[model samples]
Target chain A: MTPALDPVIHPIQRLRICALLDPVTEEEFAALRDLLETSDSALSKQLSALAGAGYASQRRATRGGRSRVWVQLTPAGRRAFHGHVAALTALANHAGDPD
Target chain B: MESDAVSAREALDAVSAARELNAERLRRPKRYWIMLGLMLAVFALLPYTADWPPLLRYSAAPALMILVAVVAAWRQPTAVRKIRLSGRMGLQLVGFALLGGVVIAVSRGVHLEQGWWWAPLVAAVLLFAFVAGVGPRMDRSWARRASHGEE
Candidate 1:
């Protein structure tokens, strides 16, 4: 077995962030906030943590002189998201199997 | 693409599980048959006399299917759960569906006829089989293992 490459995908919120971002090109802060059901400060904190881990990327854009915070997955983040998912699945399967 | 390049490994590793079971799994729709029937009927109603043809109509069925799959599957599940297919698979399936349509439309002509009837359905069935066939093996393996705290 490959030892099932499991990365520490910390804090449920950050995990959710990676999950949502894994498939999206880029998502608005508000949309992510809605999905994660977390406050702005909390979401930002998780996002920043993910950014530091190189699992995610954050860009601040000013449109019409208003700041826009965009959250996206780095390729690493996407893979981590997938791997995280796979490990979870593996766990699920193990639990479900009668054998 | 630099940023894209960096996270490629994680993306691959993460969705590898999804890819493994992607095609085999499907979401139950609110009105799946109704949706398919409506799409086919709408495509049928389109004027085939036009130059652009009615490829879009034929193409709509799979598109709607993919859309529904995305919406239904779009959610965050705690407990380290893997997403069913995630976003990448959805986009790929869309492209695949479009490719199927283009090939059929070009070969069979845009008119609603039975020229390439088996192609799309066969393709779908084959894909479904590919996914479904692998299900048992996977069930016996990692998915089962994971559930038992083997991970």
Candidate 2:
């Protein structure tokens, strides 16, 4: 049987974001944005979606007189991300095989 | 590319790439190994200096430790601002504590029985093994664990 993929996390941008956050405990918002090569508003929008779904969390703090935001994946998010990756791998593995 | 256009193959690639990136960032810098080597050198040599004045011999190790701490602080970032997902740091702390405790116990017991003339040589060999072999192997293992989503 094929594994079920998470539709919510199946989007390219969301998949990339989840992939990036899955490894680190937390990442700086600006760094994620730069890495994703997306604008502030766009990244915020995606983060908002993930937050709404309880897949990610964010915190704001002031450092060196500058406010910074950091983002991290929740436990639920990690499980979901790993599961999605597993599904992806399963799909890729079967890409050339007969049913 | 549109979200709908992304295939499972591409998603897998992205995950692999991201893991690689984090592995690189989370890796201890080369200077970290160098500092560890210097610290081990100081520790390994201290056991052999049993003939010096008690105060001077005892003070030398602490002084070197303070120097290493000061240098690490001065060179490394004060606040990394990033969360470390790997358990390597915790493992290193535990490993060092256990190793130090055992080494001190053995060296002191041997010194009481006779002269622990071979303490320094044993320590040097053990530290060489740890730094050149155990350390990198542990790092790679932890990095693999971290990359696999095991925090």
Candidate 3:
């Protein structure tokens, strides 16, 4: 199949979020923010956008006597992220092709 | 077009770095493996405790197993979002079980308690060694697979 870029994941921050989330079963919200070096509000906005697109979801859980938000990609989100990566790889590889 | 390609390549590099970082974050501490290895060693030695009273022999292994589980949960790192055993780890566990079973069966066949009471003890020691030696490598392999989106 011809790979196509996903608009939802095309933005740099959102794409980075998906890249980080794709590896693990779930990640704590604060950890994600720390890794991405983005503020809570900005990370939340990006996550909300991904969640709105049905690509990601978050849940609140109490751990170590504190409430923490955990985020994970939905199955659809994983597929979309992988597809988006494949599209990017294709585009990058095409750079070597002759006109 | 050239600039777009450069950016795409850069983005892919970012993805690779993210995966590597995630894998590193998922790596467990040495203490975790030591505790786990000790627990597993005790579990392997349970069969040798058959001569003990029924209550002690039957309950000890299960109780220790539960304690291990509780400790593991309590000490789970925040970086480890969730524990999903990869196929390789699962296979390693199955292999451990099979090898353990063989040790028990051989010990029984030779009536280890007669003059070779140390057979099971040796087996338990070997099992502990296996865990201590191979556990970290298995964890590394699992982390790599998970980070690469292969799990």
Model 3, position B120, has a per-residue lDDT of 61
TM-score for chain B considered on its own, for each of the candidates: 0.28, 0.66, 0.73
What is the C-alpha lDDT profile of model 2 across B31-146, one tens digit per residue? 56555756776777675677899999999988987797688668575324243445665777598668855765676567657776776667656765667566656666566667
B3-115 per-residue lDDT for model 1 (tens digits): 43334344534444433332222222323333333343333333332345478656755676667545544662211224234344456547655654554454335233655
Q: Across residues B37-141, which tens digit of lDDT does each residue of candidate 3 receive?
A: 767667657667778999999898888877876776685653233645777767876997787678656655555547566766776687678777787787777
Best by DockQ: 3
After superposing candidate 1, which stretches have Cα over 4 Å from the reference?
Answer: A2-7, B1-151
lDDT of 3 by residue, A25-63 (tens): 788899899999999999999999999999999999996
Per-prediction interface RMSD?
Answer: 14.0, 4.8, 1.6
- lDDT to native, each model: 0.52, 0.74, 0.80
DockQ class, candidate 2? acceptable
Runs with alpha carbons beyond 4 Å of true place in candidate 2? A61-68, B1-6, B40-63, B73-97, B117-125
Query: Model 3: how many Å of interface RMSD?
Result: 1.6
Ranking by lDDT: 3, 2, 1
TM-scores, one per candidate: 0.41, 0.72, 0.83
Candidate 2 chain A least-lDDT 10 residues? A90-99
Tens digits of lDDT, candidate 2, A1-99: 756898878877988899888767888899899888999999999999888889999999997899999999999988888788888877777765665
